[model samples]
Target: MSGSLTAIALDAVLEEHGLTLQQLAALCAVDHDWVSRHIEEGLLTPSQHGGEWRFSSATLLRVRRIANIERQFEALPELAALVADMQEEIDDLRRRLRRAGLE
Candidate 1:
């Protein structure tokens, strides 16, 4: 009984129907205003229909990354965005490396 704890990983299947602003806020553990601020800062993108906003799984992932950086490092929104940008670039490189059999 001396092994490290193991956690189950779920392959979350985001609803193809898309998520609303409130749903996104709940997932990100932030308030509506926080999400709005990110959107205003040009960090998060949303699609509007009939004056309501909707987000996709990719946006959810990006918001989670931005929120983590902001909370963990106390980074400003812009700084967190910069970090997210670099992280995305690293992710792209890793994907390329894997494609090239270098990873």
Candidate 2:
């Protein structure tokens, strides 16, 4: 074991999230390979160590946020502009809903 205390802390964080890589990938709307590669490259750190793979809820959350942004706003400049316009409209609707106490 790397360190008993460190392992214990990692386990605690995993317990709070209770997600597997597949689940996280689904939530992020990205391929499992991408997540795995990112982890292997040390771009993301796992919260817990499984037999072969480690998982970090915090890292997965960040990935999901990025994936959502990318999906909503495609990479192309034209698509990005359209997505931004749509997002602005959505934001306005959300604000109106909140003010109406229906959010």
Compose the digit string of candidate 1's lDDT tens values, residues 8-100: 111133434467899999998999999999999898889875688988777887899999999999999999988988898999899999999
Where is model 2 poorest over a 10-residue stretch in terms of lDDT? 76-85
lDDT of 2 by residue, 1-103 (tens): 5698887786687666556778778867778887776667555566665554545655555566555555666554334434545665787899999999999
Q: Best by lDDT, which number?
A: 1
lDDT of each: 0.83, 0.64
What's every prediction's RMSD, in angstroms? 5.6, 11.4
Clashes in candidate 2: how many? 2
